[model samples]
Target: MNIIQIDRHSGQTSSQILAKAMDLHASGDLHEAEKEYLAVIARGYRVTEILPLLAGIATINGDLQVALDRWTTFLDLKPSHLFGLMEKGALLHRLGRWQEAVVSLQAAERIDPNNPDLLLNLGIALIDAGRGHEAVTVLKRVADIRPGNPLVAHQIRRISSAIVPFWHIPMLNDQPRNDAFEEGIKQAIAAHGSTARVLDIGAGSGLLSMMAARAGAQNIVCCESVGIIAEVAKKIISANGYADQIKLVPKNSKDLMVGENLDKRADILVSEILSSDLLSESVLSTFEDAIDRLVHEEATIVPRAITALGCLIESDVLAKYAFVDEVSGFDVAAFTELAPTRLPVHGKLTSWRRLSDTHDLVHIDLRARKHEASYRQVDLPVTADGIAMGIMQWIRVDVAEGVEFSNPPDHYSDGGWLQVVHTFSRPISVKAGDQFALIAGHDRTSLILMPAG
Candidate 1:
């Protein structure tokens, strides 16, 4: 055979070019080493081995883009290179290209599914990509492989707590609320028979669905929007032996399909979507959608109506949380404009003086098929000579014909639903006979509370 010259112009063989490149790279002469490596690649000599060497050299010089290019070239020749995919993903994460990082890491994870380092990077990339719920799956794999790993456990907890609302845990412990809802479901099941299809819009922990199953209902479907919570519900439901009777759908009530998700429109509907101010969680839109699509013409809605009960109150402790005038001797009253109009206050822990008798501020008939953004002027009659802060509101649910539940400020404490302080723009001094002409209504999702001209 004729002697092979990889670089005819330099009269050097392929082995000689690679040997010089390796020596220069080892001696920390990256500039000269890269030139030799490029010559080797140009001469079509050992490109597969030289590309990774070039990439490592570029990395050493902090040339991330060039390193990434070398890695891409190397991967193009060998797409199944797991470490190449991982290195590319890590660089993308550092560059803040989160979604792309997730894509790359996921590819590596498919090859070496048991590598903790690989799975951890994938989970982190998924979280940075704003897909934390999806990250839970990856982290769970790591969790299983590396049992008792506090870091993996902590990551799972962080995502779980972030996605699940704080109110859900407390709401589950609210005996009065739970009892009322359970009683209503029992009544509905009794009326429509045990086999009637019961639908729970916000099936947190699968509580209501299991309650329906326990109350002799044969069929129940519950929907939860939070994916993590939905996973928890599946475990809880399965553990409680209601897996056959209850079908949990991981979706918002608005997204639930009538024909597919549910065999037909439900015969009974129940949901606990009310926030502190009553409408902040889009209860109106949720209920309206449930009526128009999810339920039958005369579906036995568990909470047939929701009433927002409130009273004018004055409290020094409560005012600071809302309207801040002088702070550290600075008149930053303008900051009060950005203050939250309502606060979820613990009824038992907070102190306040009622300046007016309790009144029914807004009444919602949940059975209605539709609702409009309603606002009207109202006169809130005062009973004492004190500053009018705003309204201390709570929810009163008409669960059934003879069953009802409420968390009034005075009578309710440490319940799932806390009393809300609906504050005004500023403190208004008023006499005992004074009346506040204020506008109150639902803006479809949030409550409107403001002074009327």
Candidate 2:
């Protein structure tokens, strides 16, 4: 009876300590709350729940190390505890331990597969770990589940952007990205002459607007969304003696107002907003919004349309860029799991083969009277004999009157953007007269190509 009394007394004391901790925590006295929580934990009371609260307080107070320790303790006591697992994973991510975070979050996901938050966190963790392609797979799921979530959408854009190979930037400069604009500008000028009111979205280096001005445009409003780049563009416009003819708006394509930024609706719309893979920069939405809200209905859009070109190609050269196979007589296959990336790829530098000769992917008609979402299954006929590596993509621009340009596969050569070759897992061998079906669409920020029937 005496031993029972002692046990009851101990339980009462533990309960009292937990109550005090809860009260303090509820009152926002986290430091005092922490003390009480520790006291309850020391007394062996509700370790799972109390430890998470302690970890939460620590996390909120910016004591990350303490939070990590507390979360670890909670997980040890309750390994499959969903909240505890997520807290620990998030903490690991905060500490830049991306791989560890992915494992933890993935475990948590296995425990609770329907949790969108867990999936989003896992995607973020994967991205931080440098597994961009993998991250895209996870993030795309999140996007489908939470269509209006900007953050999830942003992550999708980020991952889609990274799928491009890196070596193409220098090569892009050598291509005709700028020259295409120049030709388009001259055409727009000849069509409208000096009387044309021009709007240039994404005015990189202010080159397109200056080209417009040189082609004799008056009342040219050039909007560059990047501040630093806009500043440089402003200087370039001044240097090129077209500053008086051009007005620069240092804001995003969406931030510009029709009346506030321009006296009248633009007669000609000029923009160099095409990224390597076409939609990586949300050119579809930007053009749609600009056209619907900012520009006139009949406004001539430079690069009136852009065709997103893609093809199945094979490359032994691209192996190193996309995968880590053999390294110094060691097979570090596990390390490939930690690979990081978040940008488009250029196929020019990588050793690859055109399994099925280049094919056109989806094309966004920027000059359409109305913009709408659409998708179609495309059957690409293989006209060449080669191993199909993956989709090689580029943009073919219909700049202006009689000015047609293409970032041909032979050249990842262009300015500001390069043609991206998205490699597949394994090469698909094909010969002349072979055909493969693929589903292709533009989701505002990404051009998706998936295998179809």
Candidate 3:
């Protein structure tokens, strides 16, 4: 594939030319050094070494294609050249040849699988190639090799942030949600017996699967779509001694097949895929698919019900997301239409007064086979006299009989979950004892709440 295939030019003075090239290269005279290296290369005297020197000189002189061609030529002569592959990959990445960059680095990786530098280059190229999940897996291996390397850690963090949602790390730290899920899993095992096949959707860090294992559920299949998370979850599950009991699959729940990705239909379903306002994670569709295709009839579903609860509130901070009137000297109220429909709010930190008592915005029974997106009008009982900005919503998970969790605004400050404020098209005025009409429901993927006449 390289055009630099020249016939060997045998000469008596080849050694002399190579020595002068080395001297010129060391003296930083790259232009002169390149000439001599080319002379040595043309003479077929240590062409491999001379080619790399000539390529490096071309790269320094800003002739990347020439450098790439030289590397390609060298590789054609000696395809298994390890450093050549790495250099070629790095150059390919710089040239925005994404997939080719990954392929080259991967070739180098196959030769020296555990070399940290090679792995690092491969990981970076994978990110640029849009293979973020695999990049993260590779970067994690680099981290294991060079523990204190800041660049690898930063790359891992950057790639992870781009691929995984920000809430997962915090969600893992949500003790109440964790405790409720564990309790529910324990009860399910008690009722279904330890041998019941369990499916954990949105496996995340494999926490729920591990919980099922702790409760003595022997057969667990957990699925997570994100590659890096799935790989790290395997390590965590193994570290916790549940590797044999739990099987992790990097796939969406909808794509999983019974008897293929699962032994049979699941007998117990353990999942915490509920979003902040309850449905933003596509919980309805995801659960519906699993119930229809993956889980068996009468499967014990954790959090048999979820409630989206909220109160109409007034907040100066939240108003900014809803409306704008005078800026400089213009009637900019129309600009409010371009504002965000909803925003995540930390209940304790956000300044707001409830205009009405918390009401059930929407509720879904997880055991239901299907959910239809629908809306209904609610007569919210106003408890105070204030301007109603919008509805401030949170979630309640009824895991089991006595195991339930709700991240109410006043208490759930640190959880990965946050109360979402669905800003109204315009702020509405209300008074104590006035029943405010509101439209409330979900589009299946997000909670929808707005003002009603």
Candidate 4:
């Protein structure tokens, strides 16, 4: 087909040029349509209407930057234009400019707060920008407006997976953990008196704070780093009738101030920030900071001590995930180095056989003012003859003096704490009577597990 060349000498009107541009755009001749649209804009003919069409054509032509520029220009003319803002924001998101997209979508959200489409886009931008907590909040609003929307629910789940671990729900329902923490709170109140000021760090669902309040603690401060979790904790604390007694601080424990955030240092400190691998949640630094800046010299610490316990394991199922050698007759053992060092495994769901008796790998004193990373070598007597895949590790929490909780893989079925598999570089074969030397410790934020040479 030949190009439809417009003759400037024929006195073509702006309306005529716009009609030709629309016809070319409808016929899928975007290049010609863009030229005609530009001519129409130059003549100042229906600039607002033609600009969006030109932008759409640019988008269709695979010129995203051009499309973004066109939409930006249209927005300048009509700052309050709803669709203009939406297009600009959406374009920015496609271009991988997440923060810019968030800014634009936020403006659109301000214009129409109840619009589900705007909220959905804004939530996506927030997630892309590594703001999953904020995304969850925005997406929850979307769910409220459009009930039973599967996409909203799916997005919420996706964001939740990234922000919160899978074990939190089960942990919340763990009767033993709850009972242990409650007992510890009661003991703390008994020792420090009911009026003692309490500090709860990593206040997930505000369960510990409510426990303290129920134990007759008059003043309590709880801090949660995740904003969404903190908001939900507020609701839970309020619903449980402890809102007045418990103060919710939506910031990290490291940021809490003694005089400004709290009237004085707390008399009792309680926290449930322990991870499956013990130190993954920065519990060491958090507790150390609390002891330094947020707690008194003799503050009663719940879970006064924690220990990382583990046993050697052997499993074909776990081996498939941890180490891979050959695939389709090709040696890919090198790929095993790229595998995750630590894997969260459901205690009851995963199949594995213990090859050695459980032993304490590391111990942490919660009352200590400072901590340094340390490693130690220990020998474990093998109880079974099998190929060693890794060590399955769990945590033992000594909450107060008498209350204690341990998530051993054999008896602990349902809880937030999943047993972690610390995989070795390669599988080792051993006999029942063999003794295995192992190195274990922590680097403040993660557990270190390896076989000793």
Over 1-453, each residue of candidate 1 has an lDDT whose tens digit, in order, gives: 898667443777878988988999899899999998998899888888999889888888888888888988999998989989999898888779999888888888889889998999899888889898989988999999999999999999998787778888889889998999899988999999987999999888999899999999988999999898899999999999999999999999999998999999999998988788888788988999998998999889988999888888899998988888888999999999999888889877898989888877788899988888898877888889998787888889999988999998886876788889989988888788888787878777877767787
For all predicted structures, in order, the TM-scores are 0.91, 0.58, 0.80, 0.90
**Candidate 3 lDDT by residue in tens digits, 251-355:** 999999987999899999988888887887889888899899988898999979999899999998889877898899988888988988888889999888888
**Clash count per candidate:** 0, 17, 0, 1
Candidate 3 structure lDDT? 0.89
Candidate 4's residue-wise lDDT over 52-120, tens digit each? 998998888789999999999999999988899999999999999999999999988889999999999
lDDT (Cα atoms) of all candidates against the true structure: 0.88, 0.76, 0.89, 0.91
- Top-lDDT candidate index: 4
Number of colliding residue pairs in model 3: 0
For each of the candidates, the C-alpha root-mean-square deviation to the true structure, in angstroms, is 4.4, 13.5, 5.7, 3.4
lDDT of 2 by residue, 263-291 (tens): 88888898876777777777878888888
Q: How high a TM-score does candidate 1 get?
A: 0.91
Model 2 spans with C-alpha error above 4 angstroms: 1-175, 320-343, 383-387, 411-416, 425-432
Judged by whole-model lDDT over C-alpha atoms, candidate 4 comes out at: 0.91
Relative to the true structure, candidate 2 reaches a TM of 0.58
